[model samples]
Target: MNIYRHEMRMSLRSMLYWTTGMLVGLLFFMMMFAAVSEEASVINLIVSQFPSEVVRALGLSTLDLSTVLGYYGYVFMFILLVASVYALKIGISALSEEIRAKTADFLLSKPVSRNVIVTAKALSVITLLALQSAIYSLGAFIIVDIITGQPYDKTVFLLINLSIFLVGLFFAGLGLLLSVSIKKIKSVLPVALGIVFGFAILQMLNQSLADPVLAYLTPFAYFDIARIINARAYESAYVISDAVLIVSFTLLTYIIYRRKDIPSV
Candidate 1:
């Protein structure tokens, strides 16, 4: 419990800042929805002139910019990207912070077991993730309502925003595993940024190639924003894949962290 409390306290400010930035950015983008929607046909036509693969890669093909949800879903991809980076940064930083700061020895001096410590760290990250998702989603819905003054499917809007939570979990899990697996992490932001963008690049390939195999490589591809708009629900296979990968990463983190030697300052 002490460990959990400590982790949460350490993470709270960073989480709030990131969530606020994302919300503000989303608001800025959604504010343009009215103007964009009015010119949707011309924009869509210009988008169509590009190669089909390029169009699909940009997600300009399926998502119509004419509707409220369509525009939200389209621009929301940037939100997801930022959210993923934030999640990964915290995940990598959470466990690694103690070590990087040369405080692991002091932490291990406590009576609590390593397993308990790992559980606390992981749960703290998860809790912050849930709060971040909730805060931003609520703000998002309210913003859209106020700006558009137009009715959109609440359920689908939610499903679209829910991608942030899912992607956060996946990256958090990966961060924990990497924290335990790597011998040294000089800086987490660069590592997190690189990895997230690498996967995002893979998502571009997945979109362009339309490959199921490539899609599995990137969590960004898991929740198809456009598909969520159309289907009004998440895709089962990708959801399952996300669950499996998160669980696997978490389990591997536990196992590796348990027996690993802790270097003292």
Candidate 2:
């Protein structure tokens, strides 16, 4: 419980910053929906000039900018990217911070078992992730309603936004494994950014190639907005993949963290 509270206190401020940024950015972008939807043809024409490969890579080939959902889907990628970074940072820093701060020895000296410590820290991060997602979802709902002032597919809109949290789970789980598996993480932000972007790039390439096998490798491809909009649902295969990956990452984290040495200052 102490560990959970400590982790939450440490991360709460940064979570607010990221959540605020996403909400404010979403508001400002949605405010332009009217203009964008009006002139979507010109924008589409300019975009069409690009090669189909490039268009597909950007996920622009499928989404129609004239519609509210399509425009929201396009911009939602930015939110996913930013939120995943914060998630990865939280996951990677959770267990590793004790080592980075040279307090691992002190923490280990407590009466609590290693498994209990891991549970507390993991729960804290999960709580923060849920809280952040719920807050952004509410803010996004209000922003879309006020900015568009027209009825849209509320279900699809929600699924698109829900991707932020689902994809975040993948990143957070990977981060936990990385935190325990790696001997040292010199700086959390750079490590988080690099890993998140690397997977993001892989996702873009997978889309460009239109490869089914490659899609399973990256979490970004799992809750693809274009695919979601077209099918009107999340793919069961990807959802299962996400669940399996998260469980695997978490289990590995527990095993490695328990056996690994914690050096003293």
Candidate 3:
């Protein structure tokens, strides 16, 4: 409990600015939804003018755009991108900064165990992501509900939130692994960002190549937003793959971190 509080305090202090910025950015996108929902002609014009590929890429689809959920989902595609980036950023410093700042030595000098430290940090990251996601979803829901006056699928909405949350956990584990393996914290953020963007590009390429087999190689391909909308259920393969990645990375990171020579603070 003490470790959790300590780690949560550290994470919140570091990430509060980014979380606030994400919420503000999400608000702007929600406002755009409000504007577009005011006119049926505008929605028709958009659907007519936009290419099907473009619409799918942007997470806009053959759904009724005037409805609050559809509009919120449309705008949320971009917000998701930002939120994912923020997740990577949070993870970059999760363990890497402790090593780089030479604080790991001081912390370890205490009675805290390595697993406790790792678990506490993991909890902190998950807690931060949940808080940010909840705030963003709540704010958008209120804005959209007021504009459309209709209740949508709360189950599906929560599913979307959970999917993103799981993805964040995957990235956090990846970041922790990198932090343990690499000697420098400065390299953590760029490497994490590169890996994420690289996965996205692979998903795009797999689509271009027209290969279903390739979809298994990347998370983005399996976790398609359009499919998510149509099915209203996250792909089980992705949920399983993410679970594997999280577990694999967590174990690997713990092993490496335990062996690391901690420098003085």
Candidate 4:
């Protein structure tokens, strides 16, 4: 309990500045939606502003933002990707920063074991993620409603947001695991970006490959917003698989971090 509290304090303190910045940045994108809502052809107006390639790259083609699911999905993805930037910033530093700052020596000198330390840090990261996602999603929802004069199904909104939140935690685990394994922060960002983009690209490839089976290979491909929104149900397979994979990876990270030796700079 003490370890968890300490880690939470440290993480919140370290992330206070970054979280504010992300919220402000996200507000810019939300404003775009608010502006377009006034137009009769709201969807087309929003789509027309972006280049075809830009739209395709961002997965906008797969979404139709006029419907609640589509709009929520579109808005959700925008906010998620922007918020991920902050997550990666923190995740890359979770372990490496401690080592680099020479704080690990002092921290590890404590009575708590490595597993406890890692667990606490992991929990702290997850908490911050949940807080950020809720703020952004809820804010977006209210803004959408205010501008459009229509309310979304509260149940569906929460369900979809929860799914997105789970996916964020999965990546958080991945980030923390990487932080423990890799000492250098410089390379972590590129690798993380690569992993994210790679998943997205693979999802796009599934379209031309015409391989429904291959769709399961990419996390981004699963839990699609359009399908979920139209059907008004969660994708059980995606939720299950994502949970399993993230939990497995987190466990693997804890084991490795416990046994690994910290190197001196």
The numbered model that scores best in TM-score is 1
Off by over 4 Å in 3: 34-66, 187-192, 206-210, 263-265
- Residue 9 C-alpha lDDT in model 3: 78
Which candidate gets the maximum lDDT versus the true structure? 1
Candidate 2: how many backbone clashes? 0
Against the unseen true structure, what C-alpha lDDT does each candidate score?
0.92, 0.90, 0.70, 0.68
Query: Model 3 — which ten-residue stretch has the worst lDDT?
Result: 55-64
For all predicted structures, in order, the TM-scores are: 0.98, 0.97, 0.82, 0.80
1-265: candidate 1 lDDT, tens digit per residue = 9999998888899899999999999889988998999999889888879999999888888888999988998889889999999999988988899999999989998898889999999999999999999999999989999999999999999888888999999999999999999998999999999999999889888899999898999999999988887788899999999999999999999999999888766
> Could you tell me how far off, in angstroms, the CA of residue 242 lies in candidate 2 after the best superposition?
0.4
Q: Tens digits of per-residue lDDT for model 3 on 48-131?
A: 698666654444444466766666665555566666666777776777777777777777889988887887887788898888
Tens-digit per-residue lDDT, 1-265, candidate 4? 7867876777775456654565565456555654554452766767779976666656667666555455556766655554555676566666677787878888888898988887777777788887766765676566556655666777667766665467677677777777777656665567777776666677667644547688777666566766766678767777788788778878988888988888765
Sort by TM-score, best first: what order? 1, 2, 3, 4
**lDDT score, candidate 3, position 39:** 81
lDDT of 2 by residue, 12-41 (tens): 998999999999989888988999999999
Model 4: how far is 128 from its true place, Å?
Answer: 1.3
